[model samples]
Every structure is written in structure tokens, then in C-alpha cells.
Target chain A: MVEKDVIVNSDAGIHARPAMMIVREAMKYPCEVMLIKDSVEADAKSIMSVLGLAIISGSKLTIRAHGEGETELVDFLINLIEKDFRV
Target chain B: MRKLTVRYFIEGEGRIDLQLRLYAGEGGLDKEIKYGEINRPGLALAGFFDYFAYDRIQIFGQGETAFMNQLSYEQKMKTYSDFFSYDLLCCIFTHDYVPDKLFLEFAEKKNVPIFLSKRGTTRFITLFVHVIDEIFAEQVTLHATLVDVFGVGVLLTGKSGVGKSETALELIERGHRLVADDMVIVKKIDESLLMGAGSEILKHHIEIRGIGIVNVREIFGIRSVRNRKRIEMVILLEEWDSAKEYDRLGLDDKKYSILDIEVPYITVPVRPGRNIPVIIETAALNQRLKKIGINSARELDEKIKKWIMTEGQK
Candidate 1:
């Protein structure tokens, strides 16, 4: 498994639509992905789970993934979070 | 799960068939009932069709029937014609009220099915709405174990051998009820509510790692099993990793979506010496507290913030 810590920078933080985008991106890779905020962890591939974190701007998130292409998956997720979920 | 039509309604079992019989427009029995709600077309009969929900099953109760009875032959024809002009699934006359001749003529002419029921108007409407709700509810089957812990429907999900069944069994032994084991079939009965049940073959049967298939009802008694339950929360179990930091404060809320509806979600790490069942019980209780508008973590956070503010003032 691979893990990375990144700060949320989106102006509106991570809401429904942005969380859905993360789920969509996470589904592209054949890996089990999870998002950790403080002690709460959520399935990165689940839109509802991602939104459950109630992540706001400046919130620190730890992304973890296992299986094939986990490294690329984690990097892609970190980049997405760092980029503020730009189109 | 599937569309219900007038034909299915007439042939369906239960009290619906007790007094219900097709009166007119047999050709329209296959017409689908698009909406779950039934409508009483009181204003529509008076030439008001602005908000007429034509897709609903029209109910002709005492008031409607009395109004129809008071109408002249010409007025009745006009009203019935206008009412049946829209594409309606069917019309039901309760209290065994027979349809007027002109009403039947308009119904047959418009190809709208009409049914007669011996049940009173209110009772019939309630029963029909419930039956239609069941037939048209959205359903999805999930690979998980569902248990009612402290009156909360807790769905346990994870990999095949993540101890979902084992944890559910433990919960059952503690006097909780098991809704489903292995596969949970969830149905969205309302806008935001989901009801879950087990398949016929797997109902009340739970598979432990090495214990084979155990009948929860037999071992734990009837009170330990439920036919169906409304899913309120989801708990995902995963193997514990020392390097991964788990949520300790639980200030961050989480959710899991099933069938387009969001429900509370939590992930519990599995490891030796960890009392998973006890943790789950507390989770269920905590969920109940949240439902009642009491959030302990948020309350504590507010308290700490207040203390910090007072110390800074001093």
C-alpha cells in the first residue's frame, strides 16, 4: 500500500460534486483507495464516504491505496486534491 | 423494482382483490400506474385540470360519487369525458359504489380502467397506496450483513472474509436482531429511507469462518431475527495497519450512499485484542444519539474552545 498527505485547497472545500469527481477518478485504477481525515477514514471510491469527511479548505487529508497501480493512484489523488479539484 | 399496471393490481393477492373487480375498460388494464400517490379528482370534475395529476389512480369516494350523482345527464357526460380525457391508469369506486351508466360509457370510450371495491374510500386509498409503494420501490442487493443493534439498523460491509458475519453473530448473542446475513437486499421505500432484507435462501442464516452455515433464528430465538429493517448506518471493517492513522476524535463525519440515498458511515479497523462487537454496539448507540441531535464530539470541541477563550481573557 502507498500513502500520501495533502491539504485541501478548493475554495468551496470538498462537497458533493467534488467528492463525486474524486470517486470517479479513484474508480479508474484497480486499487482499494481510502481517504483519512484525523481518525476518520472513508472509501475514496464512494462519493458519500468522501463527503462524509466534511473536508474544508486547509484540512489535511491522508490518501492510502493498495493493489495494482496504487502508487500512480495515490499520486493522481494527491495532485487532484492539491490542484483544488480543477476541471 | 418494476412498474405496476392495472392488470397486476386486479390480479394481485391480499385485501385488494377481496372487493376489487374490473368494471369497465378491460383494454386499459395494462396501463401503468406511474405514481405511487392516489388522487381524488374533486376539482378536476369541476373543469379544473391545471394541476390534475392524470397519472395517478383516481379514487371515487362518497364525496365524488355524490357529486357525480347530483350532476345532470349532460353535465355527467361532460365531466366524465373531461376526467377520462387524460391518460389515467385507472379509477376506483370504493364502498361498492357502482359506476353510473354515463360514467362507464365515458370510461370505456376513453379506454380507462375502472374498478369497484367494497372497502371504504379512506381504507381503500391507504391500502392501494401501500401496495403500489411495495411494487414500485427501488431495490438493490448488497453483499453485507445487516443487524439491528439498539434499534439502529447497522450494515457491516468489507471484503468477503472481513468478519461481518462473525460480528453480526456476536451482536445477535447480545440480544440484537439480525436482518440479513451474507446478502442484504435493500429497497428504497420512500425518498430517503431504505429497507433491507435477506434473500429467501440466506435469510436468518449466517456463515462464520469455520462454523459453516448457522441459523441465527434457531440458535438465537425468534427475537434475534427480523424480516426487514430500515438501514440507518453503515460500518466498513478493514484490517488494521500500524502505519495508517485511524480517526481517533471522530469529529469528521462520514457517509455511505446506497441507491442514491446517503447514510451515516464509519470504518473500524480489525486487529487482535480489539473488541469489535463492543465497538459496534457503541457505534450504534452513538448513531442513535446523533439522530436525536446530540453530538458528543462537537459538544466537547465547543467546550474546549470556550475554555481556551476564558484562559486567554484571564
Candidate 2:
């Protein structure tokens, strides 16, 4: 298992657009990816789960992944949030 | 686990029929309720503080009220001063019995909330306990679909894009009710029953690979969807692996544990030409039969053993 915590610096937090981007990026990996906030785990591949977290600016999120290529998947998600979900 | 505060309880009073009116101590509305069981504080009021469960929501019925009414001003002051010394959750007076002026004064001074309910002592306790139990219930969010088939709640679980939604859609078309799709919030109620429901934003909506999000209630009418259901079985839909051996005889029972409760479980391999929905309906019916003491597999085995013995005797 691989896990990394990142702070969401986006001004708008994880609204619909940024939530979709996170889901889309997580879908590219075959392993299971999860986003956790306040001890509640949400499936990263599911758009509704990602949005349900209601993540806001400066919120701490933990990206956890298990199975093949788990470390790369976690790093990729952390990078996505750090980059303000540009792509 | 989620924390339950007095404010949440007050906000949810309408839904649970608590019929509570905040009488005093608005500042203490944020006090946490740690236990589900309520306390009467009758002994504590009489200057006996042994085994006093001050953390629980204290209930002041007629007996406690009468006792308080009989206390003299000096006695009331002494007793209440001792009572409010401990960190308490809140106090509720049933039967519309209002506390004395001194009691409310002490409550306000100590930042302890007091509420009044018109319901009788017994009725109010029943309702209060019911709500508190649910608030403290164990809960988890699962990435799956929940459907009610043949009066049985079946939880369909699997990885993403494993046809859980497709199978649930087909089940809905066949007259089954869809409780939730994609993200199912399951709560273990009363330490036995597992109730599954959807999140507020995602309830009654399903996401298909090509069709986007479809509102099941609007598309299939109200009868085709339910707000929540008790999860009695769990079925995991996985890709068909040639090397893996599946359960064929159905002799051994498989269980899936959620929140420490064991539920019947089955793994169904997904492949083309297999009617997964119909199979789920049958499994639900079979589970109902087993619940009624009619084990088809065991009964059949018993009959075969008796026949084989008769043949050997002949």
C-alpha cells in the first residue's frame, strides 16, 4: 500500500470540475485508489464519491493506493492536486 | 464514527418525533452525547451520586420532578450545585413537567442544556433511545449497488466497470427496487441489522458507462426505487477467471462481514450470455426459503442417502 497527504491549494476547492479531473486521473491506473478526508475514505475513481468528500481549499487529503503500480498512482494523484488540477 | 451533539439532536427532533423544546442553556447545545442509554438521575438528585451516569442524557420524569418540588430552597441549591458539578450532556423533562426556577438558574450558570417534552415519561424514553441508537450506529460507505429483490436486500459489490450498475438496472427492470447505486452508505443498526442507503446527493441516480447518470426514480417510477433497505446478502461480481474454481454444490456457506455482522455472501463470475439479474432473483428467493427452515440442498442430500440405504438393503 502507498499513501501520501497533499493540501488542496485550489481557490475553488474540489468542486464539480476539479472532482471530475481527480476521478479521470485516478481511472487511468489499474490499482485501487482512494481519497480520504477526515477519516472518511472515498473511492477515487467514482466521481460522486470524490465530490461527496466536499473538499475545500487548504483541506488535507490522503491519497491511498494498493495493488500493482500503487506508488506511481498515489504520486500521480498528489501531483494532480499540487498542480491545481491543471490537466 | 460520527459525533452526535445536542445541536444535531435538536435539529433532528422533527424527523424522529422527539417533540423537544429548548427551555434553557443554549450555550450547551454543542455538548456531546456519548452514550445511547438515558439516565433518570433520581438517586443523584437525592444526594446519592454513586454510579451516576452523568454523561448520558438525563431524563426528569414525574417522580424526579416531584422530588425536586418537595426540596426546600436551601436543599435545592445544595443538590443542584452538586449535580451541575459533573460534566453532563443535557437534561429533558417529560410529561411537560417544568423544572424549578433554581434548577434552570443552575443549568444556565453551568452551561447545561435543559429541554421539555410533552410526551409522557415512557413514550419519550422510547423515542429518545430509538434516535440515539441510530445516531451511534456503526456506518461505512461501500463502492457497490444495493437492490431489493423478493423482499431481500442484496448488495452487489465489485470493482469499477464490473457491470454492477448494469445488473442492478436489469433487476430494476424486472420489478426489483434499487436502494442505491455506486456509493452505498451502510449502517449497522442495533448491532445486527445492516441498513444500506445512498448519499443525499447521489440517491436514486445511477451511472452507466455510456448513458451518463440516470435518475432511477424518474425513469422507473417510485415503485422501482427505495430510499433504504436492509442488506441481507452480498454478491461480488468479478471477471471470469479460467484458473479459479467456483462454488458448485452450494453446501458450504460463505459470509461477508460488515461492521462485525456476518451476512450471506456469493461470488458470481461475469461473462457474456449469463443472466446475472435472474440469477440474483433466484438467489434471493432461495435465501428466503432457507430462512423458513427449508434447506433445499440439505433436504435433497438426506433423501438421496435414504434411497441409497434402501438399495443396499435390497
lDDT of 1 by residue, B1-314 (tens): 34457787568533234358888999898787667788899899888999998898888899989988899988987887778778887888899899788888878887898888989988987777776686578777676789999999999998655688889888998899999876677888888989998766557877665565577899889999999999999999999988989989989889899999999999999997899999999999999999999999999999999998998679
TM-score of the first chain in candidate 1 relative to the native first chain: 0.95
Residue-pair clash count for candidate 2: 0
* CAPRI grade, predicted model 1: incorrect
lDDT tens string, model 2, B157-211? 9988789999999999999999988888888886789999987878898877777
**Native contacts matched by each model:** 0.00, 0.32
User: What are the RMSD figures for all models against the true structure?
Assistant: 13.3, 2.1
Which 10 consecutive positions of candidate 1 chain B have the poorest summed lDDT? Answer: B10-19
Q: Chain B, TM-score, each prediction?
A: 0.80, 0.94
Model 2, CA-based lDDT: 0.88
**Which residue segments of model 1 deviate by more than 4 Å?**
A1-87, B13-28, B42-55, B74-88, B105-112, B117-134, B301-314
